[model samples]
Target: MYRCDCKSNVLSVLLYVSECWKFTANIEKRLEVFQTKCLRRIMRIFWPNMISNEELRRRAGVSTISEIIATRRWQWLGHVCRMPIDSIPRVALRWTPQGKRNRGRPKETWRRTVDRDLKTRGLTLQTAPTIAADRAKWRSLAVASSTRRRRED
Candidate 1:
């Protein structure tokens, strides 16, 4: 019942080592048949370093990335792989980055959300006046009142 500091179970850790060994054996056997000995062993053995064991599971046996999506575990695996940065689904992870906010803080536009139903009635901008217009009206009223005060004095 010893938990390795690497957070790997003893039995499963051994199984993972065995899987890596089997992978190397399979790769070597296939490559030997082709007579290509100059293949970089390190890259194939550990391709583009994954951050977690869950990600290792996803990469090792999951054939189609779409299979990962269908199971709805892609997001879990994505976080395990430190892949939350990419908005694209792993099935189509290479698509054009659309609506991605990169630089600076996100735009905090004051969208005028309404509680009224819009299905039957239409979108009508009835009396939502601009703040500047209201300010101007108040300023004109204040000026007129001050002028009246001076005349009364």
Candidate 2:
């Protein structure tokens, strides 16, 4: 596990988004040929033998950058869950600054993402904090949600 920095949460999310964009920039779409080539190139950096992308993915248990980011977010969420309600991390999670709405489509918030994740696991925002307090259960929920999403892809 890693320490969570509440102040750096937004920055960390941005960095994750940028890294994911960089990873997929070469591919126009997630076509199999492109995905295969990309995976092969990545694998070759660590192995010399020519191997089929399928074999490489199987051996490595392929996971997308988004999946990794989601895992990190969930871990941080668990940490926040364990904090006192008045603590900085927990306060940040619950805080809603009063501001006028922008004139265009609204920017996504971390709360929205958390809500979506919880919804996927048949959980509600009201119940999530309690569930997240149990490290093992929370970790399993995160993994199960990610695995379900992967299967849908």
Candidate 3:
């Protein structure tokens, strides 16, 4: 019997998801369709025994890729929040450069996604860092946020 570490599995899944996102970035399609396609491909790689979508869903019993990404974004947020103010991640989170409006609409950023996730959990930018300082508490919040998002979908 072979056992895979949960952290390694998650990291692998995240890497796969980012790759999928890169491929699908320019293609305009409904979110459901995009997610379904990505999920199918990811499931194929991760769980070969679960040949059907229904079986994959049943056997995996895990959050969707989007939810996992959201969870990870929050986890990163927590880590960045605990870092020094001058740190790169923290600076990136706080800084906005002077730029021309070269687009009709701005693309969604990781920070924006984190903000949305925080809002859904009744948290705010100012308070998130403090809340996330507690490791166990932050993990619970991230997991809960992912599960809640999954249920809504």
Candidate 2 residue pairs that clash: none
Worst 10 residues of 1 by lDDT: 110-119
- Candidate 1 residue 83 Cα shift, in angstroms, is 42
Stretches > 4 Å off in candidate 3: 1-55, 60-62
What TM-score would each prediction reach against the true structure? Answer: 0.14, 0.63, 0.65
Write down the lDDT of every candidate, Cα atoms only: 0.29, 0.62, 0.61
Candidate 2 residue-wise lDDT, 1-153, digit = tens? 011221143224444433212223233234344444545554453456767654665654554546665777778778777888889878877778898767894455567777666677888766878998788999998888888877886
Q: Write the per-residue lDDT of candidate 3 for residues 1-153, one digit (tens) a residue.
A: 011332255446544534223223333234434544455555544444436544544444544445555565666678888998899878887777698657775666556666777798899888988887898998998788776765775
Number of the top TM-score candidate: 3
How big is the positional error of residue 83 in model 3, measured in Å on the Cα after superposition? 0.6
Pairing residues by index, what is the TM-score of model 2? Answer: 0.63
Model 1 reaches what TM-score against the true structure? 0.14
Write down the lDDT that model 2 would get.
0.62
**For candidate 3, what is the TM-score?**
0.65
Q: Which ten contiguous residues of candidate 3 have the minimum total lDDT?
A: 19-28
Better-scoring candidate (TM-score), 1 or 2 = 2
